[model samples]
Target: EPEVTQTPSHQVTQMGQEVILRCVPISNHLYFYWYRQILGQKVEFLVSFYNNEISEKSEIFDDQFSVERPDGSNFTLKIRSTKLEDSAMYFCASSGLRSTGELFFGEGSRLTVL
Candidate 1:
């Protein structure tokens, strides 16, 4: 099975700096999403993208956050001005199903801000 892959599995950055997390979802999947788990907390949806545009986004995906499908095959999340509270394990998921449907999750990229 083709699974999602994320780069920089773990990153440590300074506060106020910028960080870009990259992901490659299943090639045949139609819907792509980004979610984050704050350590021991539950998984939270950040944003969903489809057909080159944002389909849905949660409050967590604010002005400082952005998503892009720069090359059609890869999806990317960029966090501008990193903060201490931004540390979490970000997951990339994709599915051939609907918004409220099932999804496949990546290994996750852990972000740590100092």
Candidate 2:
């Protein structure tokens, strides 16, 4: 089965630096989303995209963060400036429907901000 894949499963970065987390969603899915989980916390939605435009974004997706579909297979999230609060497991997910479908997630790209 096709699955979402993320690179650099773990990353350690200093505060105030830039980071780009990469993901490749399932080939046939149309909607993609990014969620973050702070240690021992609930998963929070950051952004959702479809048809090359943002479908929805939460308050957590602020000016410092951006997402792009740079190619047919790759979706990327870029943080212009990282912060200590940014340390979390970033999950990339895809689903066939936006409202009522299960999301398939990557193992996660763990970010450690110090």
Backbone clashes in each candidate structure, one number apiece?
0, 0
lDDT of 2 at 12: 98
Per-residue lDDT tens digits for candidate 1, residues 15-112, read 99999999999998989999999999999999999999999999999998999999989999999999999999999999985556779999999999
Deviation (Å) of 90 in candidate 1: 0.1
List the candidate 1 regions with Cα displacement exceeding 4 Å: 97-100
Worst 10 residues of 2 by lDDT: 94-103
TM-score (all chains, Cα) for each model? 0.95, 0.96
How well is each residue in 1-114 modelled by candidate 2, as lDDT tens digits?
Answer: 889999879999999999999999999888999999999999999999999999999999999999999988899999999999999999999987455678999999999999
Error of 2 at 52 (Å): 0.3
Which pairs of residues collide in model 2? none
lDDT, residue 91, candidate 2:
98
